[model samples]
Target chain A: MDLQHIRQDFPLLRDNKIVYFDSACQSLRSQSVIDKIVEYYTDYPACGGRSMHKLAARVTEEVDAARATIAKFLNAKKKEEIIFTRNTTEGINLIANSLGFKSGDIVVTSDKEHNSNLIPWQVLAEKLGIKHLIVKSLPDNTFDLAAFETLLKKNKVKLVSIVQTSNLDGVTNPIEQIINVAHQHQALVSIDAAQSAPHEKIDVQKLDADFVVFSGHKMLGPSGTGILYGKQKLLDNLQPFLVGGDTVASSTYTEHEFLPVPEKFEAGLQDYAGIIGLAEAVRYLQKVGLEKIAQQEEELNEYLTTELLKLPKVKILGPEDAKQRGGIVSFYVEKVDVHQIALMLSEQGIMVRSGQHCVHSWFNAHQLKGSVRVSFYFYNTKEEVDRFVRELKKIMNVLL
Target chain B: MFCFIALIVFAILGIFSASHRALAKEAFQCVFRRVTLRACNTGFKEKMQAKILGKLINRSSRVAKFVSHRFELLAWIFFILSIVSTVWVAKGVYDFYVYGNCNGLNSTGFCAFDPKGNNSAVSTISTRPCSLKPPTESDLTLKNVNVSLFPTKNTQAKNKVVLIGCYLCDYTRKAYPLIKKFVTENNVQYTFAHYPTKSASSYLTAYVDCAYQQNKDKFWEWNDKMFASSKEDLFKPEYVQSLLGKEGYDVGKIKACVNSQATKTLVNKQIDQLVGTGVYGTPTLFINGKAFVGPKPYRVYQFGLKPFLFF
Candidate 1:
């Protein structure tokens, strides 16, 4: 409601001239979380966990506390379920890498994933002699329940990975329905929250996903850090994909043993400052009231998507209903090269992502070139949306 | 005549001074800053569109289930991370653009993506068409040709005049003819002599030793085979003779020669010579010792070669 007050929380908002709309790609960080991270480095910089010293101990405590905070935030069963990762991409890759699927086993995923979700399974399927089946989404970007049911009936599927919200169209999938289908097939589910995590409420327990992966940077946290929330049993069963310092419990030249659960997956010395900042970022969101954040963002989304439709030549993808969508509005204006449009949009100090949004198959299926995607967040406002629409009209007058 | 000469010189100097001042005024700073500006504008527009669309989509729940608090909390955390990732990635990018990776310093610690020194010299290393003073008799001994598509006619003969170093790394076709297909009723026989086996320097050395130095018939035979296909033990010296002998070559003497310190000394000598001329990267062709790096269009090669072939 008080956008001016909200803008004060983010240093990026202080720039009077620029309007940033690509929150699905990455959101602006609040000053409080950023300051907390800076404080950790300047006032109490030390390596987390390998020592008894005050700073080292604090870093370790803060990191674990952050994990606990994230676990609770996700409604995950335990703190141990949250494994810090490079990003959602790495988290999916970890499952695809370590699930130890035997030859002929199937890995089912929806077509709406960012390459982060698609590539790892595709690569792992090829390498491990497993089959990768892509469940098709309807033209509007909603999951085709019949296609998913057909794949589930085959019974060979070992894992099901889906993005909770489509990055391209901002469509919120019937992921809970798919999770139920996967469980019936005795398959584990991995939820990619790269696009969804930043703008929706989630409860991993209710969804019954074996793993839920999301990036901190997409929300307002530090970059190069993400969470891989896995069930403890599955986490224990999985092999370590990256072998390095922190992952090993003990090692000799002949035989080295891996550490248990989260530590085993952590591998090397992490981006400590980033992770510490992310923990503070989590705290900042909690204070803002996640519900208020959602309400504010919805208001912004309602404002932007309507204005986008005013340009007659533009075609918006994803579900037609606002209820089935997040804050993303993906569309392409006729006769404008998506890259050129993106390049032009940049010239006007607006940040939107173009290209297939790293989901190549969706583009291939639609037989369309790339589209322009503008996403929103809590800090965004109606006035900003009006300016953006005016800019679009100007851009259209120039190009279209 | 003196007045005319003074006028021309003054005009030239004035033009140079004016252009220099204009260059000094310079508008755009960096391409990256422009990228950030554009992203901001796009962000603003996206929000406006989402809102208007929301009004239209709320038919049943005109009440609107447009946002989820859970997903929002998730987004906030990820946004924090994106900035950190950008900043974290930026530190190394900055370091790389500066001090670089000299003396084995940890590049990450120094805020570098890798070693800054690695790419720093790349700009300094010229990638332009070289202009030299009139060619001396020593330099213009043979003609140069760049083969864009292979299985070229008289390739065996072409090897002698030009050391054709093929690029298999990029999966450009390496089509060495079958023994049955290569030697026809009237065809040049490509030899398998003096090819390097298993070393990183094999392609360059093979071009030098067999084609340039020896001019053996079996030379291009090995050259095509190397690029056309991949091998398991490409870097091993023992492999050269084993593979080449099967490809049909009488190289008992050549094999012994290649193993000797003399041949190794010669290969080293050639490398030093090329490096001395400041050869930065690979697939470099020294036609009569005049370097042509990367793939050249056949016409360009034809043009450059006509003078030597004619002379």
Candidate 2:
């Protein structure tokens, strides 16, 4: 891939001199995606599925096209399986509320799940009296498949919701194996692919997970757009979490008939502009290829990790191997505050995420304050990493 | 400690910017927590320190290290300095309100509130070319100065205001009306001692002395008319005589008194008495034995008369 050209696609990287290493939180949108969003407001600004005018018909067609494109991006069985959500949190909440878990049902999750994945199950336990069991990771913070399988076997687990890639450490779990094992116990598997879907290729059909959810903003799309891909039969079986104007086919004062699958799940006026922009983002990613993106990220992460390790008292989170940790390198000095490092770096126009990063449960469990997480995307260059390292070293020299 | 400084700095900055207002709000929260004896968990101090150290570290690591170690001490120093400056500014405002000059009464120092030093300006008595030295405020005195010979009013009133002024001096013109109105309203003993700072106005001084000898009450009315008259009109002898006539004074007799050698000698003696008091400027008023050498505000004269007036 032409890395310089890819960087030029993002106006923030092209126009401004900044090293953005917070892609895990939210990736910068490309020019194409921005243009697509602007196109919706300027050209055909109308409500879809409700109006019968030319603009409305055009909007409905464009929205359908975006859904089809996203369906293809996730490799879902069909377009009907893709449900539009505001973000991963909304997607997780929809499933948590719609799955209809009864009392004493068991739900298994991983230890290092993001709050989006972790909190829903916790709420489920509190509300429905379901058992929320956590499968602890290995010492290196890699997912322990054996512990997960044992938990599935011990408890008659109704559902297994886990984060495929942890925002805390950039550690990718073995979802294929976990999903297969969960299926053996007849437990429904839900994968929080918010971190994975942006940096890696995701084939939901190949993985055969019952549900896969991810955010659009983490993949260079506009914010407030996400997707929940489920098996056709499973989505048809679940109740709609939110029901409003567009979710129903025909309604009277007494009773109402719900729309099929995706439409029934999506309620109210949707973020049409964001959905159109997200589809453009998916197309942009496909053009660049996720494999190349992942490759570039790994190289950048390796260089950053090697340089960070040279500093005294620097302790990296997760596996020491950069490849295992993907594009992220979260670390902290022995005595220095992580916020200081992040803020100091930020003053120099280097953006990195600090604090618990919404993985407070994991940080609190480890009795750690949190780490400075630098996540690289394909647009990030080695020179940016060099600048980050030099700044980090200067801070360390003074602080130590 | 840092939040205290941040609160003040950002609050001032907040007046002009919305982003700084948000930071000011955050600093207020941090300060509230600190005052209640809780930890400043808002991280405002660390955030600000990191921002400062971040810039410092790029320039010199040694300086950054020094600052990092002494951050709390530096915050305390800044907090105390801000407080000191705030109090100092408040005092200046108070002084400006009460004394018409930020530095206090009779101070010719630069005052930001009265930038032109208008409150402390005086119509200087042109020094004698043969005199060896210039007169200072220390030389100013009321000793052996017989003020009874000048035009006097309300002689039985307790508080005394003695004004040494000229008819043509602008500073004296600016002060005379305010002083006349204040003394009239407050029922204070007032003495107008005419010292002809301008040589051209020497005849008016003799004319005033003669007018006082003729009719004491009408003499005050003539004095007020003379001060209110234009500078060009005061220069004209006919206009001066016309004002004395308007005040029902015997203009013909006053003119004879103005030309008489006796009136001239008395005027000279009164001038000598003013010189003995080391009077260096016109509109210099001795209020209750205190020498105020400028066109002070009415409140300042009131304050001079009643030191505990505000209380």
Candidate 3:
């Protein structure tokens, strides 16, 4: 890939000098995505799916096109399976609230799941009396498929909700194998692809995950946009999490007929501009190619990991092999505070995420403070990584 | 420890900038946590230190390392210095209020509150070819000066205020009203010995002596009018004669005495007595033997007269 040409598509990268390593938190938007959002606001600023005016018709058409684009991006069987939500958290919350779990129903998650995936199950267990099981990771912080299978065999799990890729360690789970095993147990499988969908191509039909959720902002899309894809049958079976306005087909006093599948799940006034921008983001990602993006990230991660390991007291969080860790290199110094390291890096205009990164359960279980996480995207350059390393070394010299 | 210093610095800076006000609020929270014996979990100190060290590391890693290691120690040193400077400023403000000059009574050092040193300014003694080295506050004395020979009021009163000044000098004009009011209110013995530093105004000193010899109370009234009148008006003989006549003084007889050799001898004797006191400037007052040489604020003269002034 021509990195300079790609960087020109992003206004911040084109205009300023900054090393951005916080893509795991939120990716920067491309100029096309920004233009698409502005177009929605400036050209056809009207209600979608409700009005019959030309502006409304244009909005409805654009929103439908966006849903189709997201469906194509995830390789979903049908466009009807794709539901729009605010973000990954909202998608997971919708599933947790509408999945019809009764008392003693079992739901399983991995130990390293982001709170977006973990906390919904916790609230379910608290309020609905469902059993929430946590499958622990191996010593190297990689997914333990055998242990996950054993848990499935022990419990008649209703749903196996797990992160497709761990945000904490950048380790992709064997989600296909996990779904196959969960199918044998007659349990539905939901995948949290918040960290995976941005870099890797997710074929929902091939994985056969009952539900797949990911955020838009993590893939160069608008911040308040996300996708929740499920089989048409599963989405039809699940009750709507929120019900009002466009969610209904007809309503009279106390009686109402709900809309089908995705419309029923998406309630209230939607973020039309964000949805349009998200489609543009998917188109841009497709043009760039996910495989190339993944390859670029891995190459950058390998160099970063090698340089970081050269320093004393620095410990990478995931597997030692950079290939296994994908684009993320989350680590902690032996005695230094992670915030201090992150803040010092930020002072040098190298933005990285610090603290537990919403994986507080894992960090607390391990009896450790949070680690500094450097998550690379395809736009990042080798020189930026070198600058990050240089500044980190200077910080370590003083801190240690 | 650093939060205490940050709180003071940012709180003062907060007055002029909104951004610093936000930091000041954070510093206050950090300091409150420290005072409550809890760890300062605000991370404000870390944020500030990282910003400082980040700038330093860009230039020199060795210097950054040095500063980081002793950051708390350096904070303590700065904290102590801030406290010392704050106390010094407070003392200056107090001295300026009570003594008119920030450095204390009669000091000529620079005061930020009084940048021009106006409170301590004097119509300086004009240099002459035969004059000795300029007289200082230390050289000012009341000994060997005969105050009994000059105009005296309230002779039995224990407190004495002797003012040796030129009627035409600006500094004396500025101070005379305040001192006259102070002596009258406090019932102190007051003495006025006129010594003209200007040769053009020397003839008026003989007329003042003659007027005092005629009517002592009327002489004081005439003296007040002389200091209050404009310097240009005082140069006209008709204006002086009219002012003396208005004060109910016999202007014709006073003018006659002004030309007499006897009146000149008395004026010369009084100037010699004033000079014997080592007075060197206009508006020099001897309040119970302590000499002050400036147009001081009313409070400073009161402070000089009373030991416990507020009481």
Candidate 4:
């Protein structure tokens, strides 16, 4: 509970006097994470595994170390199971393209998925003339597992892709259960853990998911860093998404041979600094303990949710309980513009996100106004919540 | 060859100066119909031929006969080449004017002639200062603050000031007094947001959250201490407790709240809320959401705010 000590690690929290509540969108960079990246840029800024020079060797070593760390963090069976990607979007796109979906094959996803997960499947289905199916969420904003199972049973579903945690609602899906059901029907599952990986501990082997995609920036790592974890066997069988110089083993004018699964998929020079920074971020997270971080976020989320609900005009979106909600509390005011409230809070030096929370389909379907979202992290405090509520009341008085 | 070129130049000059009777009619016709000027030599070509043939006849009659027989063919070829060369040069000049280069490749080396010396008049360029000027009420373009749920209609006694600065930043801390003076003197409106520019700014911003929860009224006092203290002593629990302890505040409660997850989450939310607000560094000041570059002189505010208030 010594956040002052913990807060010392994050420079942004120390320097900026404003209350920050938008960790779900992107977490602030920590000092250790920054140092790791700076080390790469300042000391050994060279291509990894491409040269025999000392700098290249150093870069290769750090890259290998990062790969091993990520493999262990995600609990991948083998180090080769993890692949570095630019971000979650690229990772999902890789899976969507490489998995070899055919015409008439169905890809199932939940209604609460982010656009990164949704758009890739939609494009895949369109390009290959395949079927993209959705498993609708219940009124409480939790996944409809039964409907998902029914869809899997009814169709020859090639893949079941879903978000491990909904970014908009901060609702963690029952991914383990969903994966189990998909496996029962012999359908492979790809979990978009962009929201979950930073906040929760992920074990690919434990979940028995075929693929997992998550971003580094969302988890206090560099912007372009991300990981796409797939089983070694599946990765070996899947086609490479991108192909170029480092990807090939040998080539003639007439034909070319690919090197291997991960390299063939990498295609270009990777973001070495970002990858190294992500490994450092994982180290930082491990030291802090994801469990403790999750607990802190949950506590803060509960406090904010309770305070927001007390307002007669405010309506909470997603699950009402904090345990289910994780770290985000989104709500819209009655007879007032949510964005205006966000502006007023901003004017008071309190920051909260406003709009559809990038869940346009869900918002549109539910006939709800874009809500003011107060997302929490380990660095948030109760006083900020109070100030935000006080400011909200003041703005409400003027507007209402 | 020089005489032949001079004769052609003279004939073209005759077209420009029609009053010049010294220019023979044959030479005038030769300029117009150069191809059909068999009898219109104006004695220039004949004199040149006679001079050349006279020397050639003395040296060898066969060579002189060959030269006189092919003279008309050689003359037509020379005339056609001169016209084509003139057009090519003109095209190069036109390209140079349009594209700032004569050759299609834009390399000055390829230009038929390097026109570099011709366009050497120094252009006097004037520019406004890179910094923003304080606006008068009539001159100021009012933009909606664009925050959701903020009422746009009412303009009353409320003075809205948005201070964008990092709590832990040395620059922001130093600028705080000037800002405080401005805020107190004007009494228009006041609010502040975190824009941490320092290495460990996030922690400083989060600490404010903890202090604010313990006693909302004393938040500003705790903030002043944060600015006043050295960066080294800023994060120490004992130092924070000692600073707030003088104000009859519960040190233990404030410490516990500061250490809580709530403070961390609030800090992160603030960072996200102001993500695209153009707040890269500390000490960014805004009035009614219109931004003004911070750490500016006190006079900037004196002038910047004076117009809006007077109007």
**Model 4 off-target regions past 4 Å?**
B1-311
Give per-residue CA lDDT, model 4, range A313-361, as digits (tens).
Answer: 8888888898898988888888766665665566556677888877787
Candidate 1, position A21, lDDT: 86
Worst 10 residues of 1 chain A by lDDT: A391-400
TM-score of 1: 0.57
TM-score of chain B of 2: 0.92
Residue B179 deviation, candidate 3, in Å?
4.3
Write candidate 1's Cα lDDT for B84-110 as tens digits. 876766665543323233212112233
Candidate 2 CAPRI grade: medium
DockQ of each: 0.01, 0.68, 0.66, 0.00
Ranking by DockQ: 2, 3, 1, 4
Would you list the clashing residue pairs of candidate 2?
Answer: none
Native-to-model Cα distance after best TM-score fit, residue A366 in candidate 2, in Å: 1.7
Better of 3 and 4 by DockQ: 3
What's the C-alpha lDDT at position B14 in model 1?
54
lDDT of 2 by residue, A68-183 (tens): 99999988879999999999999989999999888998888899988888888888788889889999999999999888888888889888898998899898999899999999
* Cα RMSD, model 2: 1.8
**lDDT: the better of candidates 2 and 4:** 2
lDDT (CA) per prediction? 0.64, 0.90, 0.89, 0.73
Query: Looking at model 2, how many pairs of residues clash?
Result: 0
